[model samples]
Target: MSRRNHTDKNASGDPRKRTGAPGVSAENGDGGYNAGIAVFSYIVGGIIVWSLIGWGLDYLWGTRWIVLVGALLGAAGGFYLSHMHGLTSSRNPAGGSGAASGPSEDGNSNAK
Candidate 1:
């Protein structure tokens, strides 16, 4: 009467034991609220500050187009900054370049 180990490797070779939960994987477990919340806050705050600056500039220059341009630029810059910050933070802390290492469908890195 020996108990079978369900966690033992299956015929396909993958471990039968679950990692995190049913659907949750290792990648999804990392970076909880700090990633999404912090990035969102920074972007929103930056946009607000930029909008204020744009309004001031329009007031001083007496041109509405300047404010519009500023708003657009601010949005773009904020989005870019947020994306970069997320990318950097998601990387390895040991300065290991943190590039994702996995097999590609086309057998090349450029295959997307």
Candidate 2:
């Protein structure tokens, strides 16, 4: 295969007039490495945040069980959060109406 020239020009003679990236869209697809990492972070982050809170409470109250409680709470919270915003969610990740949005109130189907 031949290499593309670095200074390739478009019909308008502007090399910088490029559109979106070939395959790198801002939209999120279902079930991939991104989803996996997001879910993992949700669970692990929950555990760490809750555990630290629990530990702080335990230290302040001179007790040894608050940390455990915090950890449990964190785990539960994280799981809940992940579930609500996980890959299986029906809601759009981009915060738009849903799917293609199917036209807007201005009545312009082709308007961005």
Task: Give all candidate RMSDs, comma-separated.
Answer: 14.4, 11.9
Kindly list the per-residue Cα lDDT of model 1 for residues 1-112, writing each as its tens digit: 9776654443455666433322223354344555566556666767777888889998998878766666677777767866654422454546655666677456775764
Worst 10-residue stretch by lDDT in candidate 1? 17-26
TM-score of each: 0.46, 0.52
Backbone clashes (count) for model 2: 0
- lDDT string for model 2 (1-112, tens) is 8766544444466667542222322243454566667667777888899899989989999999998888898888877866665443554557776656555566876665
Q: Which candidate achieves the best TM-score against the true structure?
A: 2
Model 1 gets an lDDT of 0.60
TM-score of model 1 relative to the true fold? 0.46
Q: After superposition, how far is residue 37 of candidate 2 from its true place, in Å?
A: 0.6
